[model samples]
Target: EDQVTQSPEALRLQEGESSSLNCSYTVSGLRGLFWYRQDPGKGPEFLFTLYSAGEEKEKERLKATLTKKESFLHITAPKPEDSATYLCAVQAYSNNDMRFGAGTRLTVKP
Candidate 1:
């Protein structure tokens, strides 16, 4: 069975606060791990693509890393504008459709 789970369904952070969200996955064969940021009422915006263990990618205040079993998304000195639902998805060789985590909703206060 392929699956994805995210921790801390919602998080409240003060301005410039740093934190990390976790995404755990189980799949037959991992093709790729994708990270995305989604604003209210809109589709997710791609943030990263981690292909293998120890692989990492970053954009602005966010960074994503992946391993065989799981992945993490780190936020560094987050601003209010950084607040959004962060989603993780996995692409498996066996299935072309992507499986998505419910997402971690972050709220950064000014």
Candidate 2:
């Protein structure tokens, strides 16, 4: 069976501080992306993807990388407005829906 486990459930960082969020998975033939929800009533915004093992993608202050066993989302010098719920997901070749982690709720304080 495949699974996705995200660590630290939540994180708090001061403005201009840096940190990384983790998402571990057990799926083979991985294909999915990182998404972020800015508010409770908003939809998740697509941030980036991990098409293959060892692949990495970046957007603005964020960087995402995928490996055989896990993925990481690195944030560099985030501001308070960067606070959001970051999610990770993966899907094998045979599945129609991707498996998602619970999500890491990050709070960047000014």
Among the numbered candidates, top lDDT falls to: 1
The TM-scores of all predictions, comma-separated, are: 0.97, 0.92
Question: What residue pairs are clashing in model 2?
Answer: none
lDDT for every model? 0.93, 0.84
For candidate 2, write residues 68-107 as lDDT tens digits.
8888999999999889898888878877887888999999
lDDT of 1 at 12: 98
Residue-level lDDT for 42 in candidate 1: 100
TM-score of 2: 0.92
Point out the worst 10-residue segment of candidate 1 by lDDT.
59-68
Candidate 2: which stretches are off by over 4 Å?
A: none
Worst 10 residues of 2 by lDDT: 30-39
Residue 100 of model 2, lDDT score = 81
User: What lDDT score goes with residue 48 in model 2?
Assistant: 80
